[model samples]
Target: MARFLITVVPALGHINPTMPIAEELKRRGHDIAYASGSDMQQYIENQGFRFFTAGFPSFKHYTSYALRKMFEYQGLVSNAFFFKVLIEYNRKLIVDLPPVIQAYKPDVLLVDCITHGGAQLAEVLNLPWATSHPIPGLIPSRDATPFTSWGLPPSQNPAVRACYRIIRLGQGLFYRMFDPAFNSIRASLNLPPLRHCVVTNTLSPYLILIPTCEGFEYARSDWPPQAHLIGPAPWGKVSAQDDECAWIDALPHDRQIIYVTLGTVQVFRSLDFYKTVIAALRDEGYFVVMSIGPVLDKKELEPVPEGFRIEPFVPHAKILPRCAAVIHHGGQGIAQDCIYHGLPSLVVPISQDLYEIATRCVSAGVSLKIPYPRLTPQRLRDALRKVLTDQSIRAATNSLQARFRATNAGATGATLLEQLARTKQPVYRPGSAS
Candidate 1:
C-alpha cells in the first residue's frame, strides 16, 4: 500500500473538502498522514491519521481587530496574507517534518491548493505531490476571468479572452510584488528562488485536482496537463441536534424559504450585510433563515423581526433541501451546495474569489450577483423575488445539479493520487488536449 501525506490549513472550508478524499484513500488500503495547524490536531487524529502540526496563527477569527481587518481587506493583503501565513507555517513544518519524511517516506503528497508548507516540503524532499484546488479560478484561465478582474464576467470571445489575459498579467504583477517577502522566507529555508509568480510556483507539476464540475466552471481549453476537474465533494444529509431539528420540523410550509450565510471567514465585515438582509426580508411574507456563522455576535444584531430567523451556524445540507432559494457570500462550497440541491442563488460578494464565483454562477445561468457596495434592502428583496420566480435560473440549477451529483469526487481524487504514486508522472486528464 502506498503511504500518502495530506496537508491543509485549519479553516473548515478547506478541511471539509479534503477529509472526504483522504478518507477515501485510507479506505482503499492506503496510509494517510496529515500536516496541519495545531488547533486541528484532535479533529485530525480522531479521523485515525497521523498528524504533524505547527502553530499556525488564527487567521480565521483572531480576537485582534487590527489583524482581522488586515485579512478582511482584499485590496493589498489578501494574497499577501495567505503567502505570509504559509511562509511561517512552512518554516515550522520544514524543521518538524524531515524526520517523518525520512523514516515514513510518503510516496505521494496531497496539499491544499493555497498552502505552501506541504508543497515546499515535497520539493525539498523530492516527493510526487498533488494539490486539491478548492477555488479553480485562482489559477489563471483563458476562458474564465481572474478574481482580480473587479467582477469581469466569463466569456470566450476573442476580445474578452484577451481582456482576461491582460487581467492575468496584472494578477501576475501583483503576485510578483511580494517576491521580496516570499524570497526572504525561501532563502532562510535554503530553497531556490522562484522562477515564476507565486501562484504558478506553488502549483504541483504532477497533478492538480479541482473539486468542481466542468459545467460549473467556464469552458476553457488552455488548462495545463496537470489540471483536472472532479466534481464537488459529495455530502450526506446532516441531522441537526434536538432544538434545531425540532425547529426545522416546525418551519412553515406556507411561504417560500431562503437560506443565507456569510461563510466562516471575513465575517467581521458582514454586520452591515446581515442587517440589510434582515431589513429587506423580515416582513416580506417569506421565511428567511440566516446562518450568521460562528464568528459574529448575535447580541450585536438588531433583534430579529417576525418571519426571520438567525442562527449561529447551520449545515448547508440541512437547510438547502428545505429552501426554495439561497443568499450567500459567493463561496465555492456554498455555491456547490446550492447547485447540488437545485436551488437558485443571489450571490453577495464580500471579497476575493467571491466576485468570480458570483460571476461564473451568473454566467452558468444559476445565480445573480450583488456586490456589497451595491446592495440595498430594496435591491436584495427584488433580487430574491426574481430568483424565486425565474424559470431560466431554476432550470439551469436543476440541469447542473444532475451533473454535480453523478461524479464521486473522493473516488476520482484518490485514483488520480494512486496513479501519481505508482508512476511518478504527470497525471494528464483523460480527455485533455493539454
Candidate 2:
C-alpha cells in the first residue's frame, strides 16, 4: 500500500467531495493524511485520517447580494473570481505547504482542482500527484462558452462555436494582464512558466478525477488525457433518527414538500431574495422547508409564511428524500444529489461558475434557470410551479439519474489513483473503463 496526502481548498464544498475517495483508499489498506486549517482537524481525525495544519487567511465575507458593480465587468473580459481564488490559494500554499511535505513525505499527492500551489509543490518535490475536482467545465473550451454572469450551453453548430471563440479572445486579453503576477510566483520556486492561470496552476498532468459523469457535461474531446469524468463522490449516508422521521411525518400529506437551500458559501444573499421566495409560495398549498444557512437570523425575516419552516442549516441527506422538488444556487454537490435522487429543480445562480451550471441544467431539460437580474416573486413562483408539475422534467431527471447510477465513480477513481501511485505514470487509457 502507498502513502497518500490530500490537500483541499479548505471549504466545505471542496473538502466534502474528496472524502469518499480518501476513505476508499484507506479502506484498501493505504495510509491517508489531510492538510488544511486547524478547525477541520477534529472532523478529519473523526474520519480516521491524520491531519496537518495549513492555515489560510479567511476571505472577508460579502455583504452584498451580488458582486460589487465595479467587478461585474470582469465577467465580460475574464473570470475574475476564479482566477483570484487560484492566485490567493497559491500564495498561501507556497509558504504553508512545504513543511507538511517534509513531515509526511507521501508517495502520492491528491489535491483539489482549485488549490493552486499543491500541484506546484508536487512538481518541486518530484512526487506523483492527481487532482480530485468537485466541479467540471471550468477549463475554457471552444465546445462551451466562457463561464460568466452570462454563459451558453455547449454547441456543435459553426455559428455558436464562432461566437464563443470571439468571446474567448476578450477573456484571453484580460488574462494576459496577470502574467507578471503568476510568473513571479512560479519563478520563486523554479517552476515551469505557464500562459493561462487556471489551466497551468490547478490541472494535474497525471490524472484528474471529476466526480460528475460525462453525460452531465458537454462532450469535449480536447481535455488533457489525464482528465476523467467520474460520477459524483457523495458522502456516506446519514442515519435518520426516529424524531427526524416523526418531524417529517408531521408535514401535511395533502401538500407536496419542497426543500430550499442557497448553499453555505455565500452568506451575501440578500433579505430580498428570501422575502421574494416567501411572497411567491405563501399559501400556495405546498410545504416548504428552507435552510437560511449560518449567518442569517430567522427572526430577521419575521412573521414567516404559513406552511414554511426556517432553520440555520439542515443536512441534505435528511431532507432531500422527503422533498418533491429542490431550489438551490447550482453548487456541484447539490446539483449532483438532485440528479442522483431524480428530483426536479429551479436554479437561481448568484456568482462564480454557478451561472454555467444553471445554464447547462436548463439545456439538459432537468431544471429552469433564473439569473439574479431577472429574479422576481412572479418569476420564481411560475418556475417553481412548472418544475413541480412538469412530467417531462421528471422523466428527464429520472433518465439522467439512471446514467449516474450506472457507474461506480468512487471505486473507479480509487483504482486509477492506486495505479498512479504504483506506476508513477498517467492513469487514463483510451478505451479503458473509467
Candidate 3:
C-alpha cells in the first residue's frame, strides 16, 4: 500500500473538503495519516485514518459562533486577520512542523493553499505535495479569471469601476510578492519550481468529476493535462434526532418556507444583519426558518411572530428540499449544498473569496448578491422575493441541479487521487530510512 501524509491548515473549510479524498484513499488499501489540530481527532479518526496532531496557532481557540458573525460583520479581510493568520501559521511551521515531517516521512504531502508553511515544509522534505483550495481563486488562467481573479474590467460607473481597478492592482501585487517566496522555499530544497496544477488545485482538465449537470464553473484556461472540477467532498450526515428543526416542522402547509443560514463559521457575527432579514420576512407571511448560529441569544432577540422560527443549528440538507429558497453567506460548502437542492439563493457576501462565488452565481442567473454591510429589510425582501418569485432564477437553479446530478463527483475525485498516487514517486527523506 502507498503511504500518504495529508497536511491541512486545520481550518474547517479546508480540512472538511479533503476528508472525503483521504477516506477514499484508505478504502483503496493505501495507508493514510492526516495532520491537523487536536480538535479534529474525532472527525479524522471516525473515518478510520491515523491522525497526527499539529499545533497551528491560527486555529487555536476557535469559537464557532464568534467566527461566523465575524464573517457576516467583517468578512475574511477584516482588520489584519489574514496577515495575522499568516504570521501564526509561519511561526508554528518553524517550531512544530519539522518534527512531524521527520516522523511521518510521507511519500507524498497534500496541503491546503492558505496553509503557507505546509507548502514550505513540503519543500524542506523534498516531497511531492498537492494543494487544495476550498473556494475558487489562486489560479491565474484566463478562463478562471472572471470567476477567481480580483482583476476587474472598467465599468459604466466611473467611481465604482475605479475602486474595482484599485482592488485589482492590489490583487496583482499580493500574488506577485508571494510567488517568489514559494519559489525560494522550493529552490532551497532543490525541488522543482511550483507548477500551476500542484500549487493551485487543478488536478485535471475538462471538469471530470464535478457532475456537470448539477453545478457549473466558468470557463478556465491553463488547465493541467489532468485537471478536473471534481464535485464537492463528503459531509457528515446529521441523524434523525439532530434533524429536529421545530420551526420548520411547525410551519403551516400553506405558507412558503424559506431557510436562511450563514453556516457555523460566520452566522453569529452578523446579528444586526440577521435582524434585518428577520424583520423583512416576518410580515411577508412566509415561514422563515433561520439558523442564527451563535450570534444572538434566543431569549434576548425580539419575540418571533407566529410564522417565524429560530434555532442555533438546523439540518440544511433536510430543510433545503422543503424550502422555496435559501439565503446564506457565500461560503463554498453552503453554496454547494444549496445548489445540490436546486434552490434559488440570495447570497450576502462578507469577505474573502466569497465575493467571487456570489458574482459567479449572479452571472449564472441563479442567484442575487447583497453586500453584507448594506443589508436592509428592503434589500433582504427584494433579494428573497426575486429568487422565490422569478421564473428565470428558479429555472436556472433547477437546470444547474440537473447538471450536477449527471456526474459521479465523489467517486471520480477518488479515482484521480488514486491514479496520482500510483504514478508519482514518493520523495525521499534521507533520515526517514528504517
Candidate 4:
C-alpha cells in the first residue's frame, strides 16, 4: 500500500473536494494523512483520515485581516493584500511541513492548488506530487479567454480574439506585481524563479486534477500535458435524520423549490443581496431555502419573508436533491453539486474564481450570471423565473448531469494517484482516460 500526504488550506471549499479522493485511496488500502489548520481537525478525522495541524494561523485570522483592509484599498492594492496574507500563511506551512514529511514518509503528496507552500515543499523534497484544483480556470490557456476574464464564451471573430489578447496582457501585468514576493520565497528555499504566471507556476509537473468535466467547462486545446479533467468528485456531509429536516418535506408541492446560498466566505458580504433576493422571490410564490452561512446571525435577517426559510447551515447534499433550482455564489463545490443532481442555477458571483464559474454556467446554458454591480430585485426575480421555466436550461442541465454521473471521479482520481505512487511518474496524458 502506498502512503499519501494531503495538504490544503483551511477553507471548506478546498478541503471538502479532497475528501472523496482520500476516502477512495483509503478504501484501496493506502494510508492517508492530511495537514491543515486545527479548525479542520474534527472534520478531517470524521472522514477517516489522519489529521495533522500544519501549524498555520486559522482561516478566521485571514478573513479578519481581509475584512479590516478591504475597505481601506481598492483595485491592485487590495488584491495584493489578500495575496500577501496567503503568501505569509504558506510560508508558515513551508517551515512546518518538512518535519511532517520526515515523520510520515509518504510515497506521494497530494497538494491543494491554492496551497502555495505545498507546491514548493513538494519540489524541495523531490517527491512525486499531484495538484488538485477544486475549481477550474486557475490554469491559463491560449485557446480560450484568459481565466481571469471569467470564462467568456469563445468566438471566432477577430475583434473578440484581439480583445482576449488584450485581456491576457492586462492579466500578465497584474500578476507580475507579485513576482518579487513569490520569487523571494522561492529563492530562500534555494528554488529557481518561476517563468510562468503564479497560477500555472503552482501546478505540479507530474499531474494536475480538476473536478470538472469538459461539458461544463470551455474547451481548451492548450491545457498543460500534466492536466487531467476529472469529473466532479461528489462530497459533503448528509444529514442523517429526515425528521430533522421534515419541514422540507412539508413544503407545498405546488411551488418550485429554490436552494439559495452565497457560499461560506462570500455570505458575510451578501446580507443586502440576501435581503433583495428574499424580497424578489417572496411574491413569486416559490419556496426558497437559503443558507445564510454560520458567520451571520439569523436575527439580522429577521422578519423573514413568507416563502423563505433561513438557516445558518444546511447540507446541500440533502437539500439539493429536493430543490428545483439553486442560487449561489458560483462556488465550485455547490455549483458542481447542483449540476450533478440536475438542478439549474442562477449564479450571483461576488469575487474571486466565482465569476469564472458563473460565466461557465452561462456558457454551458445551464444557468444565468448576475454580476454584483448589476444585481437588483427585479433582475434576480427575472433570472429565477427564467431558470425555473426555461425548458432549454433544464434540458442542458440534465444532459450535463448525465455526463457527470457516468464517470466515477473519486475512483478515477484514486487510480491516477496510485499510478503516480507506484511509478513515480504521470501515467495519463492531458485529456486522457484515467
Q: What's the TM-score of each model vs. the native?
A: 0.89, 0.90, 0.76, 0.92
For candidate 3, write residues 1-434 as lDDT tens digits.
Answer: 77777776655566667766776777778788888777667656766778887755224355434333334334323422443444445446546667877887776666665665666676566556665656544445433343322223223576765665565455555444444544555565465665432234223121122322223455644444334566665355454445455555556678788888776555335577667877888889898888776446667567777777788767665677788888887777677667778888999876756677777677667888887767889888987888888999888878777766665545665666565566664222123321
**CA lDDT, every model vs. true structure:** 0.78, 0.77, 0.62, 0.80
lDDT of residue 129 for candidate 4: 95
Which model is ahead, 1 or 3, in terms of TM-score?
1
Q: Per-residue CA lDDT of candidate 1, range 255-353, in tens?
A: 888888988775667788889998898888998888887567877786778888888767666677899999998888888889988999999988767
lDDT of 4 by residue, 1-434 (tens): 99999988887788878878888999989999999888778767866779888945455545656544542343445556656766777678888888988899999999998788888988888999999988667687776766763446667899989999998788778888877788888898898888543675568888888888898877887777778888888785443433366676677688788899987666446678888887788888888899887567878888988888998666776788789899998888888899999999999887666777888888888998888768999999988889989999999999999999988878888989999998998656845644
- For residues 258-372, could you state the per-residue lDDT of candidate 2 as single tens digits? 8888776656664667878888889688899888876788898889978998876566666777889998888888887888888999998877767878877887789998886
Clashes of 3: 21
Residue 10 of candidate 1: its Cα lDDT? 70
Top lDDT hit: 4
Error of 1 at 267 (Å): 1.9
| RMSD from true fold, candidate 2 | 3.2
- In model 2, where do residues sit more than 4 Å from their true spots? 42-46, 57-74, 140-142, 239-253, 431-434
- True-vs-predicted CA distance for residue 416, candidate 3, Å: 1.4
**Candidates sorted by lDDT, best first:** 4, 1, 2, 3
